[model samples]
Target: MVELPKRHKLEQSNRTREDEKLREFDEDIPDLRSLVIPWASMVIVAVIAAGIVLYNNHCDGEHSEDQLFFQSSDTMVEGSSYKESILERFLSAVTVEQHHVHKPVYEENHPSLFPLTTADRLGFSFVIIGLMVAAGGGIGGGGILVPIYILVMGFSPKHAIPLSNITVFGGAIANMILNVEKRHPLADRPLIDWDLILVMEPLTIAGALLGAFLNKLLPEVLLTIMLVILLSFTAYTSLKKAVKMYKAESRALREQGLKPDGTKESELTHINHQVEATDTNKAGDELLKDMDLQEGESPGTGDMESLAADKADELQKILDEERVTPMYNVSLLVGLFVFIISINMAKGGGAFPSPIGIKCGTYSFWMANGIMLGTIFLFCVYVRAYLVERFKAKERCGYKYVNGDIQWNSRATIVYPCICCLAGFFAGMFGVGGGIVKGPLMLAMEVHPAVASASSACMILFTSFTATTSFFVFGLLDPQYAPVCFGIGFIATYFGQIGLSILMKRSQRNSYIAFSIGGGVALSAVLMTIQSVLSLAEGEQHKSGGICGKDS
Candidate 1:
């Protein structure tokens, strides 16, 4: 009885030491709340400001520049022509007219690429911060980038868009480099789900193409309203998801007889070790009994050979599981990317002069688009069939799955890709990065946060690179500032990834990843809304041009 009490005391003392160790680990992680709260507050304030601007614009009776211009010319019509004029004015009020062509102002008033002014320095600082946040969340940060370039750096919208794309490309490259060798948190395989990428990316590109076409027809104010609504909803959903995950994690820790913030290693490792020992002992006893019952001439030889064979098979299984992603998948994704880029280059809009002279709304232009869509459709069908076959095979073999693995069944294969396409459509229409939208979507799907971040980063790498190349082809990217921005993006993302990894590990909370993702989206929403409101307040008229008009 005395020895039993002594043993209990010993266990209690060890538990105390483990608790102290966990406390020390928690202390090392920085308080992320300090960063998250202020940003959330900013988002709230920006949303209010946007609402005010929208209300004022609605009440002012001059909602668009086209309306004002048409109203001024009303006296030029009389009698029967007056009714026609009224009808034309009504049409112009409801739909943006695409009949005029004007020269771009940037050609005459282009700002210096590497200015040494105070505002330029301040803008660069914000860009660095945005890149770090974006890199950590696996987003491209274009929503943040475009606003800073236009508002602070004195760049016109045309120039700002390209610069943002190139900067995001740099960050995407950094994220891909960091994520490529990362392992899944609970599995022995890679962090990035190549299957998910193969299924989602092609459809995303297709949706982007369609959205880009619509962008030419949509009014600026309408697009702004839509963007704000979408982003605000996404931010709310993401933060709510984060909070739910945090509570679940805390409850799990409490059930294991640990503090909410405590590490699982101490108590959980002890229990696991005990269980493993018991299992080993049981297996050894069974093996000995089987050897005793054997009628073989050589004692223990057959049993030893059988054990070796079993070990070999287990080792081979592990090797197969840990193997690199299949080369065929890599090749297919590369081929799709190349094909998409070629199609875009051949039938370009905006600042990119088309190589094939394919005018928008023309037969040739529509044909190019049709061909692109058809190719993507065929490829998606092939990939879907392949995934179905693989999933069935895994089911037959009783394959085990790790946490956050999405079962790509028939319904999921169709539904998720369709959702991804919509996310991509928003991205292209708003001129934001695909990651800004897709990251939140992946979280909503209940994917593991780390795996979502890594996989999203891979998709951004492809999208951003394509955009950057298009910008480069058009000579829109400023040579002097491009390299500087690229270097900043690359360096910031590397440190961001390192810091985030340490924070997640020390805190024993994967929800921080969700917080990072939510934070980025919220910040983008705030910045983009502010930009839109500022434009409306300044009474800047959007340029009017037909979808098929020559490049200004």
Candidate 2:
């Protein structure tokens, strides 16, 4: 009885300490009322999600709703060169609903993994859906696509990496178009970093082309290993940066002396997607001003002053809620490694860029070099112009809070290029626009979140389009993948965008939310990496056996 009392006391003490820690954690996190969704929105979302699940579960035939336009031609799977074990692995997860096709669409031992047979059309649709989701997860969907193709689709690493870039071209295009509409309507005066884009565009183009060319030299197994490593790094960068955002937000809030309202962790915010079709351009703004103007007051007088004040308040609010979480030096250095490797690749990769053009497959060494050198020269000029402008700005006015100012809180001056280089290479190599990766990098460089997202969206479009075109011209891309990848990806992105908007509206979408996503992606990347290594080993063995048989 005496020992039992002592045990109870010890348990009570431990519980008290745990409760205290929980209280501290609660206090540390910010209250984001905007993240809370209403009950009605939640119900609607649940209904929609259930409907989708039920529909997918029941019906599993047809390429899409309109079968007349969608059909497999050159892209159809015909041979049995693809690894069978890997094919079975992916197919095992999916439901085979090709009972309608009585005749076999292709040979049983066909090497092709996708569109298994006329009966396997059901599986192909699932793949399209998966790719769509993957694209939305990564900045341009290319990062996720490569993994899916290799680990799930059972494609050769060389083919998967390049095709990954090509397939998500539609998503990038969609993302770009959306950003354009958002940023470029006169009065909207989108908070774009044009100078930054101009300075970086050349690097992006040169770096991607170089990466694409270099991609050809590596052995298949080596390439898969490299791709896996790249995925891990990309995953880490996304997640780590996200993790640091919470404290940064708190710090920024403290600096601004603004704290959000108190809300329980258990209560999630519900956001209703009530979009009003308003003319949200400069003209509309001016028109609104005109309507608000007093009989004797000019449009420029009081209206401008009020608008300025409102703008300032809005900016301050955003600033107060966000913090400048600079990336670690080690993290930034990894990017520098990528830049150095890019330079080395240009210098050491196979054929020299001779004065006389030399054609290697679809690429001309001299032409590519010439274009790169020209872009480098332009980049240099832009840098000089930027420096002069900065000097002039400093001389004219001392440091003051300006809208869209580059507010890097750490050693970000040299790090920006490394970021651009890594993102560019990855974009070119995989056809993933790297916008998702770049957006976080921009954020790390102290660019505003809104600006970062907008800038990333624009760049993603360019990167994907360039990568896709480059592959197509180089004869590495098949036009067949485009119809499926682009059409489904395009539609998926629209719905994905809407969902993201709704989620953001219902919750405080800050660093924490971003961190969760990055962590999830990184976890997936790790698994894919393991699977890729095994697949590569198995493939090499299979090749060796075939060679031995031929010799015998």
- Candidate 2: which stretches are off by over 4 Å? 1-138, 154-163, 183-192, 210-230, 246-357, 361-367, 387-391, 394-404, 407-415, 425-433, 474-479, 516-524, 527-531, 540-552
lDDT (C-alpha, whole model) for all candidates: 0.69, 0.44
- Per-model clash counts, in order, read 0, 21
Candidate 2 residues 437-543, lDDT tens each?
Answer: 46545554545444555566555655566555544544454345445666666776666555554554344345533553464346446655665577666765221
Q: How big is the positional error of residue 291 in model 1, measured in Å on the Cα after superposition? A: 23
User: Which regions in candidate 1 have their CA more than 4 angstroms from the true location?
Assistant: 1-115, 263-322, 541-546, 549-552
lDDT value for model 2 = 0.44
lDDT of 1 at 45: 45
TM-score of each: 0.73, 0.51
What's the lDDT of the predicted structure labeled candidate 1?
Answer: 0.69
Per-residue lDDT of 49-112 in model 1, one digit per residue for the tens?
Answer: 4344333433455435433324555444343454335555533343333334433222526556
Most lDDT-accurate candidate: 1
